[model samples]
Target: MSRNQQIWLGELIRCWKALAPADDNTRKTLAGLVGFAWQPPVDQREPEATPAPEPELPPPVAPSAAPPQPMTQKPKEPPPNPQASELPRVAIEEEAQLQAAEWDSVEVLNPPQPHNRQYNNLLPPLFRPLWSRTIVTTLASRRLPIGFVDAERLVSTMAAARPVERIPRQPRWTTMKGVQLLLDKTPGMAPFLSDQAALAALFDDCVGGEALERLHFFDSPLRGVVIGGKKAAYRPPQPGVPVVAVTDLGLGAPESHFNRAAPGEWLSLVQLLAARDSTLTILLPWPAAAADPGLQRCTAIVEWDRSTSATLVRRLLERICG
Candidate 1:
């Protein structure tokens, strides 16, 4: 073949080797395309056959007459450091001794006396009784305004009002005489009657003039005054009313003495009273406009601001000189 033809054939063989499928039929087709006879390369000569050697057998020995003896046990080795073994024991003993010494050195202290008798004896004879009475009175009068002497009378009025009982609804507006008649029927309304003008002013300041105009008076079964709409209606008690203080508003904190979670109990009894009595008046510290939406349902809300020093002095003088 010419050099150019040889180069062409070389390129063709390489392309066939790269692109063709590697198989016997593919090799035959490649040979036919190249115009060469197809045949597998012949083996030069048969390799000499060699047989594998058999595995060597181990030698057999005769059995011994007696069983083999157990190996002698090795002696237990001692700890690497002898002192380390005793360290823990020594430390424990020292700690115990130190604790014993400390206990022994500690001086016995006498219990303190509950009260110093010498100091107590120095006080005046009337001091103990007066102090005890003051403490008890202060503790017992939770939520009650200080210097309010008419609380009991007010409570009585609330009790006589029978606020929980249903009454005939009246017109929104009524005269002072109508109020007086209602108060007269309820035994404990003397406090409200003491200062009608002041009461009216108080109502005017609390609810707007519209509420004051529509006001109807009712006697509270607990000796207090209940002020609500003339047409307000109360539901009847389930069977009876539980004993409770009329001043209870049922808004006390859970931890307060006035909390009403428990019925017929200290503060809880007040909650029962509020639930059973619809005529109870709640004293709100803020103006009606500032009250929360939940509190808007209240029939009346009274706002009381602290009196100034001048006002207090003037009132006191008027009372004293009068």
Candidate 2:
């Protein structure tokens, strides 16, 4: 049958299985009518036991002359066809090339070694706590260039490495809270919270009268109430007055959340936020695993594993020392 016909027939069988009753006679009759047989499943039956074969007796030993001379290395055998050496050097080279190509095509099951320093150094120490060693090593092997390009590659590699697992919600929340606490502690900084009402009040307090008219909020798929209008037009935050934008793309549940927004939409959202020149603090549940393209646009890509107080303290120490 044609491929399409086969597919249709398979689908029909699946539909039948779903709709049909659990009567064995009905199933057997229907299966026979469809040119198929309903045999009892092999797994349901106990396998037959087989008798073990008897061990074979060793061959009878033959008598040897001179009480068996001391063993010596076997003489090297001559090539089967000495004339084969007369073949063209080009032919020999071609054979060697084919062998090398076969080896190259073989997949290496072992994990790759961590070698690329450029990729490793691209990530900041503060953010290193978020990624596992395996993830880092995988990214480094790709030798991705610095900047958003590396982010794209990292996301793709992460997705390929762990295709089924979704980014956990708790880590994203924890990282968001940690980053917020860190920024809040910093003097003279006004953070843009996810709470729209609170953010509106904060904007009024910070930007005030005339600036507030230029500033407006727009709802975002991944982020809520993105500060747009004239405020978004600014390239960089003014000194001593930093606008911190906080967004948490919480655990992408119900596949539709991501499906509704094309990967490009997420990328554009990130780019737009990045262009605003605000201190953009994004909390995303495992973007790499999701292969979310927006991940590549961010300045920092930190893994938010379940971090302990000791780990946090160690990171802080490293940050201070550096």
User: Which candidate comes out best when scored by TM-score?
Assistant: 2
Q: State how far residue 31 of model 1 sits from its true place (Å).
A: 99
lDDT of 2 at 31: 46
lDDT of 1 by residue, 1-322 (tens): 4454455456545755476534547755664555433443222233434664564766665677554542333345455685755666766544433332221222222223332122232323211332432321221111212333454555665779855332223222111211111121222323323333333433333333442332333332223234452334322233222111111222322343332222222223234334654122222223434544443342332332232122332232223223
The digit string of per-residue lDDT tens for model 2 on 1-322 reads 4464454446436745465634557655554554444432212222334664565876767675334532332345455586765876776644433332222122222222232122223323322433433322221111112223344545766878856344322111011111111111111111222232333333343334333322222223332222432324323333212223322332333434442334564456445544543223332324434445445334233333334233443332223222
lDDT of 2 at 296: 36
Which candidate has the top score in lDDT?
A: 2
Worst 10-residue lDDT window for candidate 1 reads: 173-182
C-alpha positional error of residue 274 in candidate 1 after TM-score superposition, expressed in Å: 7.3
Q: Tell me the TM-score of model 2.
A: 0.22
